[model samples]
Structures are given as C-alpha cells and as structure tokens.
Target: AQSVTQPDIHITVSEGASLELRCNYSYGATPYLFWYVQSPGQGLQLLLKYFSGDTLVQGIKGFEAEFKRSQSSFNLRKPSVHWSDAAEYFCAVGARASGGSYIPTFGRGTSLIVHP
Candidate 1:
C-alpha cells in the first residue's frame, strides 16, 4: 500500500512570505501525488498533482510542485502566501485497489497559519 506523510502538523508564515510544505511518499512503483487545500467548512480543493512528465508541474493559485523520484518527495511551494491561504493542506498518494478502482491515501494534513 502506498502512503504519504506531511511532517509538519502546523506551519506559520507571514503574509506575503514564501512557503513550502514537505511531503514524502512510500510506494513500490511510480507514485501519483496530489496537494489539496481545505478551508473551514469547505471541501478539499485540488492544488496540484503529479502523475508523469516534467518534474515541475504548475497548478492554480500560484502553486507548484516538484516530483523527486530519487528522494520520494513531492513538495508544494508558493512564492508568496496570502492570509487567505491559511488552511489545512493535505498530501495524498494514489494507487489502484484490487477492484481496479483508484484510491487515494492521504496524509495527516498540515495546517497553515498566516500572519499579517
């Protein structure tokens, strides 16, 4: 089974400062990674994903991720964070289950605290 871990439980960043959230995965084959953000009482929104191709992939909301096969890491980064960006971020790994259905194993999640 593939699993992902977000080491930080809570990350605090000043408004307009750069931010990076760490994610590491354990899987036998090529892994599918995703970053999701959840605001209070809101559903998780896809921030980015990495399946194949270029190591650097861009996504909405000025976010990007780099897939590092050697290190088993797909870290999410943003040049500058806004106060509205404060939310819970999750790192998930996707794999096919026995029934040929795709499933995602998510991390514990990292809560972002933005300071003005």
Candidate 2:
C-alpha cells in the first residue's frame, strides 16, 4: 500500500519570502512524486514530478523539491513566493496496485496564506 502525508494543513508567509512545505509517503518501491498547486475554485496544476533520476527536481513558478529516499519524504521549496502563489498546495505520490497501473493520490492539502 502507498500513502502520502502532508504534516501542515495550512501555512502563512509574507510576499517575497521563502517557503517550504513538508511531505511524506509510504511505499514499498520508489513511487512517482509530484507537487500541485490549485488556485481558488480551480483544478490542480503540476508543479513538478520525480519519476526517475535526479533527486532534486525543478518545477514551475520557481518551485523545487528534493527527494530523500531514506526519509521517505519529498518536500517543496520556493525562494520567493508571490501573492499569486497563495493558494492550496498538494503533495502527491503515484501508487500502483499489483501491477504497473497507477493512480494519482493527493495529500489533504496546505492552504498558503500570503501576507501582503
């Protein structure tokens, strides 16, 4: 069985400040990892994905994440966050059942609050 857990339910940061969101997953084999941002009332947009190779992956909107195999974690980071980035962020892992077939599973989501 594969499962993802995001410790934070919400976060607040000032505009232009750095941001980091935590994520943890449980799986037997290395699974696909992804970060998605969803604006109010909108669907999720892929920020980045770690399928294979390169533990450190860059994503859209100047976001990046580093995969730690031993820790069973993939955490998202941004140097400077914009107000537009103040939305809900979800950390997910692609899980498969018995075979190669996989489905996307998301965390509870962290609501980002950008203080003006």
Counted clashes in each candidate structure? 0, 0
lDDT of 1 at 81: 98
Best TM-score goes to which candidate?
1
Candidate 1 regions with alpha-carbon error over 4 angstroms: 98-101
lDDT of 2 by residue, 7-94 (tens): 9998999999999999999888878999999998899999999999999999998999999999999999999999999999999899
Which portions of model 2 miss their true places by more than 4 Å? 97-101
Model 2 lDDT, full chain set? 0.93
Worst 10-residue lDDT window, candidate 2: 95-104
- Residue 8, candidate 2: alpha-carbon lDDT: 95
Give per-model TM-scores: 0.95, 0.94
Best by lDDT: 1
**Candidate 1 collision pairs:** none
Q: Give the alpha-carbon lDDT of every model.
A: 0.94, 0.93
lDDT at 47, model 2: 99
Residue-level lDDT for 52 in candidate 2: 90
| Candidate 1 lDDT tens digits, 1-116 | 79898999999999999999999999888888899999999999999988899999999999999999999999999999999999999999999778876688999999999999
